[model samples]
Target: MDDFLERTRQALAAQPFTQLLGATLERMDGEGVALALPLRDELKQQNGFAHGGVLSYLADNALTIAGAMGLGRAVLTSEFKINYLRPAVGATLVARATVIHAGRRQAVCRCDVFARDGHGEKIVATAQGTIAKVDELPAG
Candidate 1:
């Protein structure tokens, strides 16, 4: 498990776009994975809210990580579905992902995103994804 976490961290750090968004893995275990992204002007939409794409991207990455953690192998997203719940207006966003099911070739995971406003945390978006396990990829 320590080796898996180390490899995941190194892989995440090497992603240029993820680094640009300042996304970090806060927690990872058999149950789930958590990721955080600070709200920045560059990530906002015209309405001054966190952009849908940003939320989707974070959710996708979170789910992928969770699936990989469960399988102990590198994986890629094959399909994803996202639902917007509310406007994301906050200092940062947090995404929690859990594996729903795992098969030999594919895994299903769900991710929920929350925005921390002054009042409290609110649901911003929800996502489900299908990840394909790849055997040939080099481990980090």
Candidate 2:
């Protein structure tokens, strides 16, 4: 588990945008990956709710991580679709993702985004993503 956590940490560090979002890899297990991000004013939309892009970011990254967990290699989000079920109003956002299927070079994953508040967690969005395994990251 420690090795997996370290791998997750390294992977997160490689993504500047994910760092800007202040997302942290909370846990990774045989089932999937979990991530959390604090809700900050800067992350909110004009309506004072978490922006759709934020939720999409969370889902895409979480699902991509979940795919990589299954393959034990880096993965990229080839495509994803998200459905906003409700406004995200909370102190933090949580994303839980699991791989639905893993092929040799690609995986299908599902992620559920929840808004955590005093009342507890509520489903705000859900996503399905296709992640492709990458043997190595290309030099930028």
Candidate 3:
């Protein structure tokens, strides 16, 4: 399991967009996956809050990771919806997701995005999605 998780993490790092966002795998297991990104000025909007696109990206990727890890197979997010609970103002952002259900071809997942700051972590957004299985993931 550790080896599989490590390989998945490496594959994630190899993704150009994920690398551009500086996303990291904080945790991945039977329970779920947690992906984190450090908050940077370049990632913020004009109001100095985390961009909506950034949060959406985290939710989508985290949902896919959770579903893939649960089924021990590769998966892609078919669709997802997210709601911003509040403005994200923090040092880092973490998106944690869990597979609620899984079948032969698809998995349903839920994700919560949080912002970590000097005080602590706060929920910034929530997401739900369906992930469809694939033949295999491309090697890194």
Candidate 4:
């Protein structure tokens, strides 16, 4: 688990946009990965709700990590579709993703986004993605 955490941290460091969004990897395992981001003024839209792009970013990374766990290599999102179920109003947003199926080159994954809702958490978005295993990430 420690080794996986270290590797995940290094992979995330290569993603400056993820860092700028203030996202943190909370967990990573064979079954899934969990990520969290704080709801800040900078992340909000003019209506004071968390921006849709932020939600999409959270889902994309979570699903990619889940697919990578199954493939044992870095993975790139081939395609993804997200459904925004509600406005994200909360102190923090969390995304959990799991791999549904995997083959030699690609994997199917799903992610659910939740936001603090005073009582517990509320579902704000859901996503499904296809990710392809890659030997290495592209140069920036």
Give each model's whole-structure lDDT.
Answer: 0.90, 0.91, 0.92, 0.91
Write model 4 residue lDDT over 1-140, tens digit each, in one string. Answer: 66767898888887889889889988887668999999999999999999999999999999998988888767799999999999999999999999999999999999999997568999999999999988887877
State TM-scores per candidate.
Answer: 0.93, 0.94, 0.94, 0.94
Instruction: Please write out the lDDT profile of model 2 over residues 1-140, one tens digit for every residue.
Output: 67877978997898899889899987788878889999999999999999999999999989988988776666778999999999999999999999999989999999999999998999999999999988886776
TM-score of 4: 0.94
Which is superior by lDDT, 1 or 3?
3
lDDT of 3 by residue, 1-140 (tens): 88889888887977999999999999987778999999999999999999999999999999988888766657778899999999999999999999999988889999999999999999999999999998886565
User: Which ranges in model 2 have alpha carbons more than 4 Å from their true place?
Assistant: none
Error at 122, model 2, angstroms: 0.3
- C-alpha lDDT (0 to 100) for residue 107 of candidate 2: 90
Better of 2 and 3 by lDDT: 3
Q: Which stretches in model 4 have alpha-carbon errors above 4 Å?
A: none
Cα error, candidate 3, residue 1 (Å)? 1.4
Clashes of 4: 0
